[model samples]
Target: VAARSPEPVTPSLSFPQRREKIERRQQEVENELKMWDPHNDPNAQGDAFKTLFVARVNYDTTESKLRREFEVYGPIKRIYMVYSKRSGKPRGYAFIEYEHERDMHSAYKHADGKKIDGRRVLVDVERGRTVKGWRPRRLGGGLGGTRRGGADVNIRHSGRDDTSRYDER
Candidate 1:
């Protein structure tokens, strides 16, 4: 006599349950896209226009190299590669200037989350003031031209001696 194997029974998942699972997966993807997508970002282009200061760059990277690499995505106005002040070595970061807001939109869209020299590059607008050749004015003659908090005293120099005339007067 041939013995029939018992049929395996499985509980069926509900439609809403399956839909919820799909929705959760979709939400995760949406979140990831939102985090990295520069095009959809409202802050990408504003009154300031999109600009980015890149950091953690390779020591050998040059401005022209970075510009050429990034120009494939969009038109670059300027690229300033940061160098160490003391050591004069590349700081592994650069500032990228875009001509148009749309250019930035495209550059950032493709630049973010992208690896350069085995490291990821960050893109953001430049909001800081770039001051160059800053020189502070010399404040000579302390506080309104008075010496040691005393009233303005005039010193008169005579040919022979001013001290003798002062004592006699």
Candidate 2:
């Protein structure tokens, strides 16, 4: 007697059914995009107007120029221009601290998306420290270790053998 092989299972949807499924998925994505708001993030809820992160700043932008521009809104507590460690040049970004929250909010509303020195600048409330989480990575290329504080592991050898080739002296 000959044995019969089982046929592979395939999706039984018709052409019309497949097209309807794709159209439904596309509509869901469009709805999600329409409902999304960048400024309504939960992390930016409390005391987010105290500090502002400015990006795409002109390289020739000076501290005095930044101060003069922002001073029109309110008093500034401090301005820190990020610099490259190797080149010792401005990194085209900075952190602006306001003495009052109202000033910070005013600066954020006015300066964001504004052009300075012909470069459009991006201004937003500074984000807090990122939450630590387990990030999975591919094994190999000298990256085969577990996360910290979990447990001690030896990846070089298996634990099946009890004896070593060398004697303990």
Candidate 3:
């Protein structure tokens, strides 16, 4: 048996190199998103059932890190880290696709609130695109939001079988 060495982390690179790498990864992800029309792509249908939506991820976390963290449940197919187009930086969320729907559900059950890269991430069954009439956090809809001294109208999971909610009310 042999142990595998961890992949090179950002610390191994000089500051300038790290910045460039991050920018490049962000650009790549954003460009892929721009070209991906999964809703209409027949190839993406399986992803809807076998994907876990992970939120509140650490901004610096990488895809390999996420795979190592989540693969305990089962084999992973892919990881899609979301990024902001204008900022060209991580958006603190990602979609983890598993090779099997059962694996996806297992991750949804066990990975929520699990610490990753020093941050506790939220995990849920992917819904925004699969569920009808569901909206993301940007369009005034999301699973959860913190109170900012306004009307207590915060909603998350919205009675839709979410268990990892960090509700502060």
Candidate 4:
């Protein structure tokens, strides 16, 4: 058999460029780590708390008061009443951090449907903010035109009567 020449290997990138790429990768990993629940890991054994978001809260409710109310159900580590960055006032919602999974469950159980100043609050895990990728197209004619004046917009989801609202039987 004839001997074949070896293929040439590509040169390694420069140290500075390689290090920069590594740093960027590390930062991405750190951001992803922030999204994970520590309690979800079976190997994780610590006093760290799980965070929950409560929406539809009274705008006047303070963080301390929110925490105190949830403390009756479980050990609350902290409460952050979300506020509008522009207005510098409460945004009618809050995020709660509890010290244990049991506390998180208890808070969700008892806190939901509980009225706070006549407004029932809804609580759940604090999911990452979803980016609005698209806006829905407006129906009917432009601002000045009436809805009926525009082209017909038929919704055939159920295949029912097309115009029954106006049936004068």
Candidate 5:
């Protein structure tokens, strides 16, 4: 007799359910981040002092476009855009490496809040390897972006056009 395999199950979540799920995941990451030690990681890449971590990138944004946008600050060494290994699609974020740390600093300060491909990308120095007790947004410890809807959502991570509060006359 031949046995049939069970079908895979996929659950569609409501808005609040998705929010709850995100909260739980964030909490788990928070706990894990507390014990993380970047020094022990053997697979670390890039020069932290000269690299800038950019997030909220548009998937359609290309490396050349990114380069052209960032080249204003200084000479760039590389642009490493993150992509999904399973799907091979852009992951909406990237790391831009500059030839000098001073260039990185300038970009880190001015590149943030600039629109790229119609999305305002968030820029921060590569603090994962340089700063102590630093946790990435995936680990729920970064200064920008969160699924939790609260008062602070508009505080540190306020750069997108939708969140801007310019006076309308």
Candidate 6:
């Protein structure tokens, strides 16, 4: 009887194939890291803060006053003071847009917690668009309910009463 020869075993992956797979995995990890990087994040971009939200603004604060205060940091593109439609007065908040992000950042860093018109104001980067259909909430529950300052009366007499309270005197 002739001795049987063993067959050679094949490797699951060639050296080149393993190297390519490793490179691909490394690239995927790099891409994921880049996505999480603050510098690469869209919201962290240099122009992300070109617009700023200034809160606690004096109701009488004017756009010109805001421009003057912020202009020291950079050129002002626009200034918008939120106003109440009923009273037609400033709503205690405003948005300021700067010509450059550098100025906006400067203003945000320096003006935050600073006094404007004798009131401390908050400066922050404007985030996203304002929500639509949002309404100001009433101090207490909504109007017209007994819980909200509405009067509650209990009638002492029924309609079928024979007392004739409405009879002519």
Please give, for residues 9-87, the per-residue lDDT of candidate 1 as tens digits.
8878799999999888778766654454334454334333546656556677667778877888777776777667899
State TM-scores per candidate: 0.44, 0.48, 0.60, 0.47, 0.63, 0.48
lDDT of 2 at 95: 78
Error of 3 at 5 (Å): 59
C-alpha local distance difference test of each model:
0.56, 0.64, 0.74, 0.59, 0.77, 0.63
Model 1 worst lDDT run, 10 consecutive residues: 134-143
lDDT of 3 by residue, 98-144 (tens): 99888887787688889999999988777655666555454444555
Rank order (by lDDT, best first):
5, 3, 2, 6, 4, 1
lDDT of 6 by residue, 17-116 (tens): 9999989877876665444433344433234357887888988778888888889998988877787889887789887888987777678768988888
- Looking at model 2, the pairs that clash are none
Give lDDT tens digits, candidate 4, residues 2-56: 9999999999989998999988877866665555443375433333236666888
Q: List the residue pairs that clash in candidate 4.
A: none
lDDT per residue, candidate 5, 108-148, as tens digits?
76888899989999887666776555566577556564434
Q: Model 1 misses residue 33 by how many Å?
A: 36
Model 4 TM-score, all chains together: 0.47
Q: Of models 1 and 4, which has the larger lDDT? A: 4
Model 6 regions more than 4 Å off:
1-48, 129-169
> Model 5 scores what on Cα lDDT?
0.77
Q: Model 3, residue 23: what's the lDDT?
A: 90
Better of 2 and 3 by TM-score: 3
lDDT of 5 at 45: 61
10 residues in a row with least lDDT, candidate 2: 160-169
- 5 against 6, candidate with superior lDDT: 5
Candidate 4 error regions (>4 Å): 1-49, 129-169
For candidate 1, the per-residue lDDT at 117 reads 66
lDDT leader: 5
